[model samples]
Target: MPKKHLPDPEKYELGEPYTHLGIPFPRLPATFEKNSVPLKEDYKMRSMDYLDTPEAYSLFEKQADLIIENGWKGIIDVGCRHGPVVDILMDKGYTDFNYMGFDTSAQPIEYAQETWQEFDNIEYRVMSWNEFAPAGASKGHKQLGQNNKKETDEEWWSRAGVKFKVDFHVDVMIWSGVLLYEPTYHLWFFHNMHNAYGAQNAIIQEPLKDQRAECWREDLELNTIEHRLHMYKTKYYEYESWEFDLDIFSGRRIISRVKLWQDGDSKWEDWVDTHGQLAANPHTEILPSGYKVIPYIFRGKLNFELSQRDQTLCQVALEKMFKERHSHRLADNYSRDKLHLGKMYMYNFVFDGDEPVFCSGVQNVTDKVVRVFSRYFAFEKYKTDGTTLLEKNDNFEELQYAMHWIRDRIIFWSRDKSPKFFERLKVKNELFSEWTVHPTKINIIYPNNEQYIFYTPKVPAEWWKNGNYDGFFK
Candidate 1:
């Protein structure tokens, strides 16, 4: 996927939030100052444009949930101009959440603070990161002392705040529309936010300059009204927004040529020949061009959260078992099985420490399809780390017991038809005569005419050491 575009930083309106086409721009928090100083405007524009897409919001929500699951306590919205994201979170009933918003603009802060005053836990800070760093640092504390304690960062930066380096630490940090102003420093800023502050997670949304250039170039393809119609059809998905283009052909001239449906759901609909322009109803407007929205999903991981105790135990048990039974062969033994015709694969077993519950195997059945099989074993199998088939006769008996168990439960099981496979085996041998009887079930038939007959109590612990019957009763 292409990265979002960033606007020219030089053209950004410094000290105040910039608006695009009358849509209020996302605020740039002071903390991004050192990292985004020269390219601030570009960063801001890209971040804002990306967040404007509904898909971005959904992705953020999923990431937030993942972070929360790992014990993150709060969400910090960087460059939060009017608290649009905060408001959305509140409406979703994710209340009692600790929210902190930072911005360089006091105007947006005042509005957001008033609108969200009910969220007593939420805090709004109108301080530029440039000013905050120096004031908070030991060096600035010595030089700017008492005066800095009373004056906010935004107030100072708006007048005469000096630039200084600072680091950020938080649960979830967000940056939108800020990267557009600092295009070149995006990578540096990303690393700074991720590593410096040790933040649990970070989200950024921005635009791509190439996409805009492509749109401009394609506009030349539209010479006539018909050409424009075709262009719209081809590029509709790229449009952040659009209005209905109408033309009236009065005899020889179009008396009126104007766009209609300037606002709301009316302007976002699909055009219909019979009904004229169709109205669009959207649940959320996260993207600039509403029609071509692509949803993104992401999960956040806490950099500090420890792995679960249960998970650690499961991992250790599986690793030990796998190393014992299926570890790589020694260099000298590699040629021992050179004549084995069929391809062979090994499967590792995992258990919950109570009893051997499941066995899974992954193998290439043929070139066309790969098959996987899993079953629960009735008994646990534990062999010495160095044990091999040639060193132990018990291994053979163990294998036979497992085979009998599987044949009774899985190999011959049939839901829609009678187990004709089981019946056929009984007909072919005298030892399996019990299989055709009323009270007996076909468990296992051996190659030499001997049958392993299983009843309730006769099932041994070793019978379940391999992939044998897991669900069938005696």
Candidate 2:
């Protein structure tokens, strides 16, 4: 018999894939009016009625595309002004799918209710995500996905018509252009959505903050971004992200991740890619036109083999990363099935301005080994001719480099030594052959300079057959 200690849903399960009654994305109605919508102060476009235009409709289509691609059912879109995404989804003529959307704007709520009321299992409310704030932050200490059907009205946010009458269950929840507006209740809503409302996955889109200008910095100060980078590092085993722009100044990014616990019992141990380091993320770059041409930290998925396309992007980035950082060793010919080049994962990249100054993620993993790369590209000195200072050096062996892991803790770099740091690590878009063994005892640095040393337990020599080499990380 199977063990009884595993986790599962008592009142909810993963929502079934929505079955469509007709062809996908039939023509939607053009009843959405745009001419005289009230514009908010300091705004350039129509408020809430932006969906009436073809340009803005395309944006909603993109967001809706991400939702459908995730195979989500029973969606709850936070800050869903006018429910443009709902209209896009319903145009597909899918049946048995449920949608629940909420926004603070009363006009948009009324508009959505009047328009989408024709569809069954659809709801809209003039409510904010902050209405369901349970006290305290859930830093993984709270038991999650508990939509306890018996909670009181206050517990369920059922105070009259200003809140949810009962707990809602969904496989996925989403928010676009909502994260930049909430200053305090941002993370709390994300936490409560899973812990109280039973949303297992999330797709979040927000403007990338650029602090070079005071106006941008002040705008960012009005919002909260706490615990985001850390959350991305530790929460999901695999996640997906992409970047897009509506216009030039828009550095919008979308990320979707499944809860780690949903991957089953034993697999939870392997979910977190622990070697990520948060480096300097230059949120903006002043362009020649005096406007920012922000590089999307998201162009494609840099996940750990999320897809073949993702793998190619990350592999190319990795090869270039070794060259950029001047790192040498990455296990010469370590092409074992379990710990091969395909497993080399891309975590996140930090841009200093236009150039990526830091890259962090797992280098590769094995049952006995896990190597995470924390390549700090900023530490290398640059010349006036736009090349790294290390480029001019003739004798590579004579030079020395240090990784400042902490305030005082430092690691030395040498090609002959274990845990090589900077040693001409790449050749022709591939790893060099001079690299031999994976460091048995080596340090993995985080973006914050937190240090962790990963090593395997010592074993007797000559344990495996000749050329079997199954013990070392290599």
Candidate 3:
């Protein structure tokens, strides 16, 4: 897939936050001297152009909906660039949320603080995950400190004037497009968020590269034994090429419910035993601090019943299709269990006799979009020697049928404008693409420097028409 074209960052001058095509976008400060914090080498400054993209707005709206649906009062957005998430949430009438935006880059956080100073409930902090040390190592030892005075969690929040009514627990932790660069501390960060901070859930979006062991054969051999062991320990699951890695950005987003265990906890031993089986070598050695990091699992996709009466046949056909198209080695992983955690969905096409003729598996990405993985036909051609031969290209019709079914039923927003299976579906006019207006409203803008109108399908009209979107204020 070709990468989506974005405005050049060099074209914009560094100054105060200004309107670009009528959208209020934060400007990158000329220097970081004011904050006395140098930018990290891995911190790549992003342009406000991303706000205009469909993916960005869709994710923002969806997350805000999730926050509201779960009744989560406090949210900590990690790597919040210029506080776009906060801005969107506030615009959606969530002013009561206890929102804290944190980022390693000082300039963005500084800009966010200045931009959102009017909101008493919102706070922006220039801090890295590595530097964050929560008050308590365990639930029993919870404590907070201020002005050289040690206080309990409640006393600290009360004295500090934080608006949260409950105990100091972050309901949700968001890491949007920031975890890929910090791969080394990804698991540790998740661990800390669940155990130290009071994050019950997390929304993590990262660039999904092909990090499978087979693909990293050469890289694995070149790395030190210790590094290889660590890689195997963490990323043990084998991923098929078609399972993910679809677009130019190659993004994989996951919303997970965090589960944590301490040494004394009843579930701690069970978790350790599971890890031992998954790890390279099982050993009796345990951490002296009793801090254990468990792997995160994505919430499963919502299951919708199909009209096909013979469900077992459909399952069998899907398994055969997986073996043929995807890796034969990882065929078992493509089964029911793998369907959870953003794996794949099997759509069966049954003909007149209630016979399953074709099946295609697609990955349901955040209920926003779907990516087709494998399309297969159940038919086999007989050769001159009376041997059966399975041809690949015979499933185009079935593929088209499945794609249309997904587009009409499951997908609210489509990444592909000109999909192979579907005709040209009209998106929003370019003039209305600016982020200044509410996602539901149609607002257009024309910048002075640009020749063509700047617009995007941030929120697809079809979604609203089909009653698919139930976001904030709706």
The candidate scoring highest on TM-score is 2
Per-residue accuracy of model 2 over 103-148 as CA lDDT, tens digit each: 7776656655766655557888776554454333233544222332
Residue 270 lDDT (model 3)? 20
Ordered by TM-score, highest first, the candidates read 2, 3, 1
Evaluated at residue 131, the lDDT of candidate 1 is 38
The TM-scores of all predictions, comma-separated, are 0.28, 0.39, 0.34
Per-residue accuracy of model 1 over 115-201 as CA lDDT, tens digit each: 566556676767543333324333422442324455564554444332211212244556544444333333334433333233434
lDDT per residue for candidate 3 within 298-395, as digits (tens), equals 11232222224344444554555555534434455455565343444433333324333334354454434343433223332211232322222332
lDDT of each: 0.34, 0.41, 0.40
Number of the candidate with higher TM-score, 1 or 2: 2
Lowest summed lDDT across 10 adjacent residues in model 3 is found at 277-286
TM match of model 1 to true structure = 0.28
List of clashing residue pairs for candidate 2: 25-92, 277-446, 277-447, 278-447
Alpha carbon lDDT at 202, candidate 2:
70
Worst 10 residues of 1 by lDDT: 294-303
